[model samples]
Target: MSESKALCTDTELFAAALFQLQVSVWERTADDIPVRVEDGGTIERITPVSVKINGIYYVRSECEFRVDRSGIKS
Candidate 1:
Protein backbone atom coordinates (compact mmCIF):
# COMPACT_ATOMS: atom_id res chain seq x y z
CA MET A 1 0.00 0.00 0.00
CA SER A 2 1.21 3.51 -0.80
CA GLU A 3 0.05 6.95 0.28
CA SER A 4 0.41 10.08 -1.78
CA LYS A 5 0.66 13.51 -0.24
CA ALA A 6 0.20 16.78 -2.03
CA LEU A 7 2.16 19.82 -1.06
CA CYS A 8 0.88 23.36 -1.20
CA THR A 9 3.15 26.38 -1.65
CA ASP A 10 2.59 29.82 -0.21
CA THR A 11 1.29 31.11 -3.49
CA GLU A 12 -1.16 28.21 -3.82
CA LEU A 13 -2.40 28.71 -0.30
CA PHE A 14 -2.78 32.43 -0.89
CA ALA A 15 -4.68 31.76 -4.11
CA ALA A 16 -7.12 29.47 -2.30
CA ALA A 17 -7.57 32.01 0.45
CA LEU A 18 -8.20 34.75 -2.09
CA PHE A 19 -10.84 32.65 -3.83
CA GLN A 20 -12.61 31.93 -0.57
CA LEU A 21 -12.48 35.60 0.35
CA GLN A 22 -13.90 36.65 -2.99
CA VAL A 23 -16.80 34.25 -2.58
CA SER A 24 -17.54 35.65 0.85
CA VAL A 25 -17.33 39.20 -0.42
CA TRP A 26 -19.68 38.48 -3.29
CA GLU A 27 -22.22 36.83 -0.99
CA ARG A 28 -22.15 39.79 1.39
CA THR A 29 -22.33 42.20 -1.49
CA ALA A 30 -25.39 40.45 -2.89
CA ASP A 31 -27.11 40.86 0.46
CA ASP A 32 -25.96 44.47 0.83
CA ILE A 33 -26.80 45.80 -2.62
CA PRO A 34 -30.57 45.57 -2.27
CA VAL A 35 -30.49 47.26 1.10
CA ARG A 36 -28.37 50.07 -0.28
CA VAL A 37 -30.67 50.44 -3.25
CA GLU A 38 -33.69 50.53 -0.97
CA ASP A 39 -32.02 53.32 0.95
CA GLY A 40 -31.43 55.19 -2.32
CA GLY A 41 -27.76 54.56 -2.59
CA THR A 42 -26.20 54.02 -5.98
CA ILE A 43 -23.37 51.56 -6.33
CA GLU A 44 -20.31 53.06 -7.95
CA ARG A 45 -18.01 50.12 -7.89
CA ILE A 46 -16.73 47.22 -5.83
CA THR A 47 -13.02 46.90 -5.68
CA PRO A 48 -10.80 44.23 -4.19
CA VAL A 49 -7.28 44.84 -3.05
CA SER A 50 -4.74 42.15 -2.26
CA VAL A 51 -2.13 42.68 0.39
CA LYS A 52 0.79 40.33 0.73
CA ILE A 53 3.03 39.66 3.69
CA ASN A 54 5.86 37.17 3.82
CA GLY A 55 4.65 35.77 0.49
CA ILE A 56 1.07 35.22 1.69
CA TYR A 57 -1.77 37.44 0.50
CA TYR A 58 -5.24 38.46 1.63
CA VAL A 59 -8.00 40.45 0.00
CA ARG A 60 -9.78 43.57 1.12
CA SER A 61 -13.08 44.67 -0.36
CA GLU A 62 -14.12 48.28 -0.93
CA CYS A 63 -17.67 49.17 -1.85
CA GLU A 64 -18.22 52.67 -3.19
CA PHE A 65 -21.68 54.16 -2.97
CA ARG A 66 -23.26 57.32 -4.31
CA VAL A 67 -26.39 58.88 -2.86
CA ASP A 68 -29.24 59.68 -5.18
CA ARG A 69 -30.29 63.33 -5.12
CA SER A 70 -33.90 62.48 -5.90
CA GLY A 71 -34.08 60.27 -2.87
CA ILE A 72 -32.95 63.06 -0.60
CA LYS A 73 -35.55 65.28 1.04
CA SER A 74 -34.94 68.91 1.95
Candidate 2:
Protein backbone atom coordinates (compact mmCIF):
# COMPACT_ATOMS: atom_id res chain seq x y z
CA MET A 1 0.00 0.00 0.00
CA SER A 2 1.19 3.54 -0.79
CA GLU A 3 1.64 6.07 2.00
CA SER A 4 -0.45 9.19 2.01
CA LYS A 5 1.21 12.56 1.59
CA ALA A 6 0.43 16.10 2.69
CA LEU A 7 -1.85 17.86 0.21
CA CYS A 8 -0.61 21.38 0.93
CA THR A 9 2.53 22.91 -0.49
CA ASP A 10 5.36 24.10 1.75
CA THR A 11 4.39 27.72 1.26
CA GLU A 12 0.78 27.00 2.11
CA LEU A 13 1.81 25.19 5.29
CA PHE A 14 4.05 28.07 6.31
CA ALA A 15 1.27 30.59 5.71
CA ALA A 16 -1.15 28.54 7.81
CA ALA A 17 1.37 28.31 10.65
CA LEU A 18 1.96 32.04 10.52
CA PHE A 19 -1.77 32.72 10.60
CA GLN A 20 -2.16 30.52 13.68
CA LEU A 21 0.68 32.34 15.42
CA GLN A 22 -0.92 35.70 14.65
CA VAL A 23 -4.26 34.47 16.00
CA SER A 24 -2.58 33.30 19.21
CA VAL A 25 -0.97 36.67 19.73
CA TRP A 26 -4.18 38.50 18.98
CA GLU A 27 -6.14 36.37 21.47
CA ARG A 28 -3.57 36.92 24.19
CA THR A 29 -3.05 40.66 23.74
CA ALA A 30 -5.95 42.19 21.86
CA ASP A 31 -9.22 43.28 23.44
CA ASP A 32 -11.42 41.32 21.11
CA ILE A 33 -15.04 42.30 20.63
CA PRO A 34 -17.68 40.86 18.38
CA VAL A 35 -19.39 43.48 16.28
CA ARG A 36 -22.82 43.14 14.74
CA VAL A 37 -23.30 44.08 11.13
CA GLU A 38 -26.19 46.20 10.03
CA ASP A 39 -27.21 43.46 7.64
CA GLY A 40 -27.64 40.95 10.45
CA GLY A 41 -24.28 39.32 10.82
CA THR A 42 -21.47 39.12 13.34
CA ILE A 43 -17.80 39.89 12.91
CA GLU A 44 -15.41 37.93 15.10
CA ARG A 45 -11.75 36.95 15.10
CA ILE A 46 -8.93 39.45 15.24
CA THR A 47 -6.06 40.15 12.90
CA PRO A 48 -3.27 42.14 14.46
CA VAL A 49 -1.58 45.05 12.72
CA SER A 50 1.53 46.83 13.95
CA VAL A 51 1.72 50.59 13.88
CA LYS A 52 4.06 53.29 15.16
CA ILE A 53 2.58 56.49 16.42
CA ASN A 54 4.76 59.31 17.81
CA GLY A 55 7.61 56.90 18.32
CA ILE A 56 5.34 54.57 20.25
CA TYR A 57 4.57 51.13 18.91
CA TYR A 58 1.13 49.60 19.16
CA VAL A 59 -0.73 46.58 17.90
CA ARG A 60 -4.15 47.12 16.40
CA SER A 61 -6.61 44.46 15.48
CA GLU A 62 -8.75 44.44 12.33
CA CYS A 63 -11.63 42.21 11.33
CA GLU A 64 -13.00 40.81 8.09
CA PHE A 65 -16.35 39.08 7.82
CA ARG A 66 -18.97 37.96 5.37
CA VAL A 67 -22.69 38.37 5.91
CA ASP A 68 -25.29 35.78 5.05
CA ARG A 69 -27.99 37.48 3.04
CA SER A 70 -30.11 34.43 2.38
CA GLY A 71 -31.97 34.74 5.67
CA ILE A 72 -32.48 38.49 5.48
CA LYS A 73 -35.94 39.93 4.91
CA SER A 74 -36.66 42.43 2.20
Candidate 3:
Protein backbone atom coordinates (compact mmCIF):
# COMPACT_ATOMS: atom_id res chain seq x y z
CA MET A 1 0.00 0.00 0.00
CA SER A 2 1.19 3.50 -0.81
CA GLU A 3 0.49 6.63 1.20
CA SER A 4 1.07 10.38 0.89
CA LYS A 5 0.76 13.19 3.44
CA ALA A 6 1.34 16.94 3.36
CA LEU A 7 2.24 19.26 6.22
CA CYS A 8 0.16 22.36 6.62
CA THR A 9 2.46 23.90 9.23
CA ASP A 10 5.64 23.23 11.14
CA THR A 11 3.66 21.42 13.78
CA GLU A 12 2.62 18.76 11.31
CA LEU A 13 6.14 17.93 10.24
CA PHE A 14 6.47 14.83 12.34
CA ALA A 15 3.01 13.79 11.41
CA ALA A 16 4.12 13.85 7.79
CA ALA A 17 7.31 11.99 8.57
CA LEU A 18 5.63 9.49 10.79
CA PHE A 19 2.93 9.11 8.20
CA GLN A 20 5.45 8.20 5.52
CA LEU A 21 7.42 6.19 8.02
CA GLN A 22 6.38 2.68 8.85
CA VAL A 23 6.48 1.37 12.36
CA SER A 24 6.88 -2.12 13.95
CA VAL A 25 5.86 -3.97 10.80
CA TRP A 26 9.12 -2.90 9.17
CA GLU A 27 11.01 -0.87 11.72
CA ARG A 28 14.27 -2.16 10.32
CA THR A 29 13.68 -0.31 7.03
CA ALA A 30 13.58 3.06 8.80
CA ASP A 31 17.38 3.02 8.93
CA ASP A 32 17.38 3.84 5.20
CA ILE A 33 14.99 6.85 5.05
CA PRO A 34 15.73 8.39 8.42
CA VAL A 35 15.74 11.75 6.64
CA ARG A 36 12.29 12.61 7.99
CA VAL A 37 13.58 12.17 11.53
CA GLU A 38 17.08 13.48 11.94
CA ASP A 39 19.52 10.82 13.03
CA GLY A 40 20.39 11.10 16.71
CA GLY A 41 18.18 14.15 16.52
CA THR A 42 14.74 15.00 17.77
CA ILE A 43 11.94 16.38 15.63
CA GLU A 44 12.56 20.09 15.69
CA ARG A 45 10.18 21.54 13.13
CA ILE A 46 8.35 20.80 9.90
CA THR A 47 6.88 22.78 7.07
CA PRO A 48 4.15 22.07 4.57
CA VAL A 49 5.57 19.49 2.21
CA SER A 50 4.67 16.46 0.13
CA VAL A 51 5.79 12.91 0.91
CA LYS A 52 5.69 9.72 -1.14
CA ILE A 53 6.09 6.13 -0.07
CA ASN A 54 5.71 2.95 -2.08
CA GLY A 55 4.66 5.08 -5.02
CA ILE A 56 1.92 6.59 -2.87
CA TYR A 57 1.52 10.09 -1.53
CA TYR A 58 -0.56 11.76 1.21
CA VAL A 59 -1.27 15.24 2.48
CA ARG A 60 -0.64 16.31 6.06
CA SER A 61 -3.77 17.51 7.72
CA GLU A 62 -4.46 19.64 10.79
CA CYS A 63 -5.26 16.46 12.71
CA GLU A 64 -1.66 15.32 12.27
CA PHE A 65 0.11 14.13 15.43
CA ARG A 66 2.86 16.14 17.07
CA VAL A 67 5.48 15.35 19.71
CA ASP A 68 6.94 17.60 22.37
CA ARG A 69 10.28 15.82 22.28
CA SER A 70 12.29 13.25 20.41
CA GLY A 71 10.34 10.02 20.30
CA ILE A 72 13.52 8.02 19.67
CA LYS A 73 17.21 8.30 20.52
CA SER A 74 18.50 6.31 17.56
Candidate 4:
Protein backbone atom coordinates (compact mmCIF):
# COMPACT_ATOMS: atom_id res chain seq x y z
CA MET A 1 0.00 0.00 0.00
CA SER A 2 1.06 3.54 -0.71
CA GLU A 3 1.36 6.02 2.08
CA SER A 4 0.28 9.65 1.82
CA LYS A 5 0.70 12.73 3.98
CA ALA A 6 -0.43 16.31 3.93
CA LEU A 7 2.38 18.53 2.74
CA CYS A 8 3.92 20.22 5.71
CA THR A 9 6.08 22.56 3.70
CA ASP A 10 6.39 23.87 0.14
CA THR A 11 10.11 23.05 -0.10
CA GLU A 12 9.52 19.41 0.81
CA LEU A 13 6.59 18.91 -1.55
CA PHE A 14 8.45 20.59 -4.42
CA ALA A 15 11.37 18.21 -4.07
CA ALA A 16 9.10 15.15 -4.29
CA ALA A 17 6.86 15.66 -7.30
CA LEU A 18 6.21 18.02 -10.20
CA PHE A 19 3.12 20.12 -9.61
CA GLN A 20 0.97 21.62 -12.36
CA LEU A 21 -1.52 24.13 -11.06
CA GLN A 22 -3.94 26.37 -12.93
CA VAL A 23 -5.96 29.15 -11.34
CA SER A 24 -7.99 32.27 -11.94
CA VAL A 25 -7.04 35.80 -10.94
CA TRP A 26 -8.55 39.27 -10.80
CA GLU A 27 -7.27 42.82 -11.11
CA ARG A 28 -7.42 45.31 -8.25
CA THR A 29 -8.60 48.77 -9.01
CA ALA A 30 -9.88 51.69 -6.98
CA ASP A 31 -11.47 53.58 -9.85
CA ASP A 32 -13.88 52.06 -12.39
CA ILE A 33 -11.50 52.56 -15.31
CA PRO A 34 -8.10 50.97 -16.14
CA VAL A 35 -4.78 52.83 -16.09
CA ARG A 36 -2.12 52.65 -18.79
CA VAL A 37 0.69 54.10 -16.73
CA GLU A 38 3.53 51.56 -16.91
CA ASP A 39 5.91 53.52 -14.72
CA GLY A 40 3.25 54.06 -12.10
CA GLY A 41 2.15 51.60 -9.43
CA THR A 42 0.16 48.55 -10.46
CA ILE A 43 -3.57 48.35 -9.85
CA GLU A 44 -3.37 44.63 -9.23
CA ARG A 45 -1.20 42.23 -7.28
CA ILE A 46 0.56 39.79 -9.58
CA THR A 47 -0.87 36.24 -9.47
CA PRO A 48 -3.20 37.15 -6.67
CA VAL A 49 -5.20 34.23 -5.24
CA SER A 50 -8.81 34.94 -6.13
CA VAL A 51 -10.02 31.32 -6.03
CA LYS A 52 -9.50 28.07 -4.20
CA ILE A 53 -9.85 24.37 -5.05
CA ASN A 54 -10.86 21.52 -2.77
CA GLY A 55 -9.82 22.22 0.83
CA ILE A 56 -6.68 24.14 -0.04
CA TYR A 57 -6.13 27.72 1.00
CA TYR A 58 -3.79 29.72 -1.20
CA VAL A 59 -2.18 32.26 1.05
CA ARG A 60 0.42 34.60 -0.45
CA SER A 61 2.92 31.93 -1.41
CA GLU A 62 0.33 29.64 -3.01
CA CYS A 63 -0.79 32.45 -5.30
CA GLU A 64 2.44 32.15 -7.26
CA PHE A 65 3.34 28.95 -9.13
CA ARG A 66 7.02 29.09 -8.17
CA VAL A 67 8.68 31.30 -5.62
CA ASP A 68 11.26 31.95 -8.30
CA ARG A 69 9.15 32.45 -11.43
CA SER A 70 12.04 34.00 -13.34
CA GLY A 71 14.12 30.80 -13.26
CA ILE A 72 11.21 28.39 -13.54
CA LYS A 73 9.65 27.60 -16.88
CA SER A 74 6.25 26.46 -15.50
Candidate 5:
Protein backbone atom coordinates (compact mmCIF):
# COMPACT_ATOMS: atom_id res chain seq x y z
CA MET A 1 0.00 0.00 0.00
CA SER A 2 1.17 3.53 -0.77
CA GLU A 3 0.95 6.34 1.73
CA SER A 4 -1.30 9.13 0.49
CA LYS A 5 -0.36 12.76 0.97
CA ALA A 6 -1.90 15.99 -0.13
CA LEU A 7 0.20 17.92 -2.58
CA CYS A 8 -1.23 21.27 -1.48
CA THR A 9 -4.04 22.51 0.63
CA ASP A 10 -7.04 24.31 -0.82
CA THR A 11 -5.98 27.54 0.90
CA GLU A 12 -2.55 27.41 -0.64
CA LEU A 13 -4.02 26.81 -4.08
CA PHE A 14 -6.35 29.76 -3.64
CA ALA A 15 -3.49 31.98 -2.54
CA ALA A 16 -1.34 30.96 -5.49
CA ALA A 17 -4.18 31.59 -7.88
CA LEU A 18 -5.03 34.89 -6.29
CA PHE A 19 -1.45 36.12 -6.48
CA GLN A 20 -0.91 34.81 -10.00
CA LEU A 21 2.41 33.40 -8.88
CA GLN A 22 5.32 32.17 -10.94
CA VAL A 23 7.77 29.31 -10.55
CA SER A 24 11.21 28.42 -11.82
CA VAL A 25 12.49 24.93 -12.48
CA TRP A 26 16.18 24.15 -12.49
CA GLU A 27 18.25 21.22 -13.72
CA ARG A 28 21.67 19.97 -12.70
CA THR A 29 23.94 17.79 -14.77
CA ALA A 30 27.33 16.38 -13.75
CA ASP A 31 29.21 17.34 -10.62
CA ASP A 32 31.31 19.88 -12.55
CA ILE A 33 28.31 21.45 -14.25
CA PRO A 34 26.34 24.15 -12.50
CA VAL A 35 22.59 24.21 -12.22
CA ARG A 36 20.79 25.75 -15.15
CA VAL A 37 17.33 27.10 -15.68
CA GLU A 38 15.21 24.46 -17.38
CA ASP A 39 11.67 25.76 -17.40
CA GLY A 40 9.81 28.61 -15.71
CA GLY A 41 6.73 30.73 -16.02
CA THR A 42 3.53 31.82 -14.39
CA ILE A 43 1.42 29.28 -12.60
CA GLU A 44 -1.77 28.91 -14.55
CA ARG A 45 -3.37 26.09 -12.60
CA ILE A 46 -2.52 23.31 -10.15
CA THR A 47 -4.08 20.14 -8.80
CA PRO A 48 -4.30 20.18 -5.03
CA VAL A 49 -4.30 16.40 -4.81
CA SER A 50 -2.11 13.72 -6.23
CA VAL A 51 -3.65 11.43 -8.80
CA LYS A 52 -2.95 7.74 -8.65
CA ILE A 53 -2.41 5.66 -11.75
CA ASN A 54 -0.84 2.24 -12.18
CA GLY A 55 0.26 2.24 -8.52
CA ILE A 56 1.94 5.61 -8.96
CA TYR A 57 0.94 9.00 -7.64
CA TYR A 58 1.37 12.14 -9.72
CA VAL A 59 0.83 15.80 -9.01
CA ARG A 60 0.10 17.90 -12.08
CA SER A 61 0.25 21.60 -12.75
CA GLU A 62 0.12 23.92 -15.73
CA CYS A 63 2.28 26.91 -16.53
CA GLU A 64 2.92 29.39 -19.29
CA PHE A 65 6.55 29.55 -20.39
CA ARG A 66 8.77 30.46 -23.29
CA VAL A 67 11.39 28.19 -24.80
CA ASP A 68 14.85 29.58 -25.41
CA ARG A 69 15.88 28.51 -28.87
CA SER A 70 19.52 29.22 -28.09
CA GLY A 71 19.49 26.57 -25.41
CA ILE A 72 18.45 23.86 -27.85
CA LYS A 73 21.20 21.43 -28.80
CA SER A 74 21.50 20.14 -32.32
Candidate 6:
Protein backbone atom coordinates (compact mmCIF):
# COMPACT_ATOMS: atom_id res chain seq x y z
CA MET A 1 0.00 0.00 0.00
CA SER A 2 1.00 3.58 -0.60
CA GLU A 3 1.02 6.09 2.16
CA SER A 4 -0.05 9.71 1.78
CA LYS A 5 0.36 12.76 3.95
CA ALA A 6 -1.15 16.20 3.95
CA LEU A 7 1.47 18.72 2.94
CA CYS A 8 1.50 20.66 6.18
CA THR A 9 4.30 22.95 5.13
CA ASP A 10 3.84 25.43 2.33
CA THR A 11 7.56 25.52 1.79
CA GLU A 12 7.76 21.79 1.40
CA LEU A 13 4.70 21.57 -0.81
CA PHE A 14 5.85 24.33 -3.14
CA ALA A 15 9.24 22.73 -3.45
CA ALA A 16 7.73 19.41 -4.36
CA ALA A 17 5.06 20.38 -6.91
CA LEU A 18 3.59 23.83 -6.67
CA PHE A 19 6.83 25.32 -7.93
CA GLN A 20 6.42 23.65 -11.28
CA LEU A 21 3.02 25.10 -11.92
CA GLN A 22 3.21 28.35 -13.84
CA VAL A 23 0.35 30.48 -12.62
CA SER A 24 -0.67 33.44 -14.72
CA VAL A 25 -1.00 36.54 -12.57
CA TRP A 26 -1.99 40.10 -13.23
CA GLU A 27 -1.11 43.18 -11.23
CA ARG A 28 -4.01 45.07 -9.76
CA THR A 29 -3.27 48.25 -7.88
CA ALA A 30 -5.05 48.85 -4.61
CA ASP A 31 -4.46 51.52 -2.01
CA ASP A 32 -4.79 48.95 0.73
CA ILE A 33 -2.10 46.62 -0.57
CA PRO A 34 -0.16 45.03 2.23
CA VAL A 35 3.62 45.16 2.46
CA ARG A 36 5.17 42.02 1.07
CA VAL A 37 8.59 41.28 -0.37
CA GLU A 38 7.20 39.19 -3.24
CA ASP A 39 5.07 42.01 -4.61
CA GLY A 40 8.24 43.01 -6.52
CA GLY A 41 7.55 46.64 -5.68
CA THR A 42 4.77 49.14 -6.27
CA ILE A 43 2.17 47.90 -8.73
CA GLU A 44 1.40 51.19 -10.32
CA ARG A 45 -0.53 49.89 -13.33
CA ILE A 46 -2.20 46.74 -14.58
CA THR A 47 0.39 44.19 -15.63
CA PRO A 48 0.54 40.53 -16.54
CA VAL A 49 3.35 38.02 -16.53
CA SER A 50 4.38 34.47 -15.85
CA VAL A 51 5.63 33.85 -12.34
CA LYS A 52 7.39 30.95 -10.69
CA ILE A 53 7.70 29.88 -7.11
CA ASN A 54 10.99 31.03 -5.67
CA GLY A 55 10.64 30.27 -2.01
CA ILE A 56 8.35 28.91 0.69
CA TYR A 57 5.97 31.84 0.54
CA TYR A 58 7.75 33.78 -2.18
CA VAL A 59 7.63 33.87 -5.96
CA ARG A 60 9.85 35.71 -8.39
CA SER A 61 9.32 36.90 -11.93
CA GLU A 62 12.95 36.19 -12.59
CA CYS A 63 14.57 33.02 -11.23
CA GLU A 64 15.35 29.36 -11.83
CA PHE A 65 13.40 26.30 -10.77
CA ARG A 66 14.43 25.21 -7.27
CA VAL A 67 12.70 22.02 -6.27
CA ASP A 68 12.49 20.96 -2.63
CA ARG A 69 12.53 17.29 -1.72
CA SER A 70 12.15 17.57 2.03
CA GLY A 71 8.63 16.15 1.85
CA ILE A 72 9.84 12.94 0.23
CA LYS A 73 11.73 10.31 2.15
CA SER A 74 13.61 7.28 1.03
For this target, which candidate reaches the highest lDDT against the unseen true structure?
A: 5
Of candidates 6 and 2, the better by lDDT: 6
Query: All candidates' lDDT scores?
Result: 0.29, 0.28, 0.34, 0.30, 0.37, 0.32
Clash count (model 3, backbone only): 7
| TM-scores of the candidates in the order shown | 0.20, 0.19, 0.24, 0.20, 0.29, 0.24
Q: Residue by residue across 1-74, what tens digits does model 4's lDDT show? A: 32223333545234322433222222225764433222111112222332233333344443322222332343
Angstrom error at residue 41, model 2: 26
Which stretches of model 2 miss by more than 4 angstroms? 1-7, 21-74
Residue range 1-74, candidate 5, lDDT tens digits: 32212214455444444554433333345664534243334445545443222233334432112223332233
Report the C-alpha lDDT of model 1 over 17-74, residue by residue, as the tens digit.
Answer: 4433211111136446522212221222222454332233334333222222233334
Candidate numbers sorted by lDDT from highest down: 5, 3, 6, 4, 1, 2
lDDT of 6: 0.32
- Each prediction's RMSD to truth: 19.6, 15.3, 12.2, 14.9, 14.2, 13.1
Best TM-score among the predictions, by candidate number: 5
Candidate 1 positional error at 28, Å: 36
- lDDT for each residue of candidate 6 in 1-74, tens digit (9 for 90 to 100): 33233323445335445334222222224664423234222212221332333433223333222222343455
* Per-residue lDDT over 1-74 for candidate 3, one digit per residue giving the tens place of the 0 to 100 score: 33433334554555535544331111113354323321122233343543333433333331233232333323
Score candidate 1 by lDDT: 0.29
lDDT of 2 by residue, 1-74 (tens): 32212212334224433433211111132456544222221212223443222233334433222223232234
Candidate 3 regions with alpha-carbon error over 4 angstroms: 1-49, 62-71
| Residue pair clashes in candidate 3 | 4-57, 4-58, 5-58, 5-59, 5-60, 6-59, 6-60
What overall lDDT, based on C-alpha atoms, would model 4 receive against the true structure? 0.30
